[model samples]
Target: MGVRVIGPLDAAGLDVALAPFLNAQEPTAAPYVGALVDRGWVAPTDAGTYVLTQEGVETHAKLLERIQIQRAAVTAGLTDDDYRTLLDLLQRVSANVDAFASTLR
Candidate 1:
């Protein structure tokens, strides 16, 4: 899924906004921003920032709705306890992978 823009933002601001969600640095995020600009999902401002076009906003909403539906479908029949256990296991797997990656570095 593409990044969602809430308002007008510069590249540096976008990098920061996306960091937690994407683990992306400015250089990485900038290209995606450019792609959005090219797609007409976002427009460059006179001030050298970008703002979502009306179409972008609508598309983002639809994307979010689709994600919600997918999440619901994936978690169907799972109780709260089951969900928590799944999350915990996923976190453990992520941690293990991070540890192994650190070794390679």
Candidate 2:
């Protein structure tokens, strides 16, 4: 999403770039745009446009790095134990989320 939204100089340009992830002509993209604003990953220009800040670029790069790492891991042959470990870790994370959510009940 950052990659799609970061390079545009204006909302129109952003709509074009974001076409793949969103319906550029609809209100469906507002949440995505709002999230970017909330995170300080993007800023509004005096011209009513948007641009990526330095932090956004840095964060995008780090996100790309993690994606590449995950892709590499998937392509690499995993031993049974490696798969088990990953599943176990994910299960633990899910359990933690459920536990935390339950507290808000």
Candidate 3:
């Protein structure tokens, strides 16, 4: 997703390329991707590939970077508020995943 989403700006293609990375049975991923598009972060090109608008792309990059930093902080054994923050973020991320899944269904 990081790689595919950045280059060419194709969130749809990013999802296709990331199919193998998903935990869904039989490589399901479109629902989440479609939900993302439906949510307005990406727009489809006539060729069927979607690109993030300038604002979406920038915002997505910032979010991805923050998530990476958070994961790294957890992996590095951060504790106290850092640990709690990570846990909080994990809960939010889980909820988002669930919400996205609901859209797919």
Q: Judged by lDDT, which candidate is best?
A: 1
TM-scores, one per candidate: 0.70, 0.55, 0.51
Worst 10 residues of 2 by lDDT: 20-29
Q: Which stretches in model 3 have alpha-carbon errors above 4 Å? A: 1-15, 23-26, 77-105
Alpha carbon deviation, residue 43, candidate 3 (Å): 0.7
Tens-place lDDT digits, model 3, residues 1-105: 354434453555576677546655545556776776787877778876767777777878899899988888656867669878988998799879977997998
Kindly list the per-residue Cα lDDT of model 1 for residues 32-57, writing each as its tens digit. Answer: 88898899889999998889889988
What lDDT, from 0 to 1, does candidate 3 have? 0.71
The list of candidate 2 runs beyond 4 A from truth reads 1-6, 23-28, 76-105
- For candidate 3, which ten residues in a row score worst on lDDT? 1-10
